[model samples]
Target: METNEILRNQIFEIIKNQLKHNNPPETKITLDRLRAQGFNDSQARQMIGQCISVEIYQIMKTNEPYNNARYIENLQKLPKEPFE
Candidate 1:
């Protein structure tokens, strides 16, 4: 697979793994949902991975809250150009 495709799949897997104990991965909010929330396609996907990274970062450090403010902060750290 192309590098971008591999990265997309990796992000999907990470999102899936994060949802493992909650609901089925297929049922979890995804990049598509993020798009529905007004983010463009690339933004949505980048935000998806960023969200997961935020969750994992919090977990590894401590059980930090994954609230909207925190998410927005993480989103801001993403490159203006998607997936660079």
Candidate 2:
């Protein structure tokens, strides 16, 4: 498989985990909010996945621990395109 597709699957897996466990709660909230705004399930998860990607990028770039605040903030700003 192509690398981009592989990465997307991995990111989606993380999103799936978040949604499954409801840890932090915001993940599902964001998903539901996006769905309410007319986004389909896959589309909403992809949008949430973008937030995950941004956080992953920052963590790798800065060697910082995961930033829950930024994650949640990005989630709340859904369909807005994360990371400014």
Top lDDT prediction, candidate number: 2
lDDT minimum window of 10 residues, candidate 2: 75-84
- Across 25-61, the per-residue lDDT of candidate 2 in tens digits comes to 9999999899999999999998999999999999999
RMSD of 2: 0.9
Candidate 1, residues 10-73, lDDT tens digits: the string is: 8777666655753334224554455666878766666667665555567667776655555544
Which stretches of model 1 miss by more than 4 angstroms? 1-10, 16-30, 36-40, 63-84
Clashing pairs in 2: none
- Listed per candidate, the RMSD to the true structure in angstroms reads 7.1, 0.9
TM-scores, each model vs. reference: 0.38, 0.95
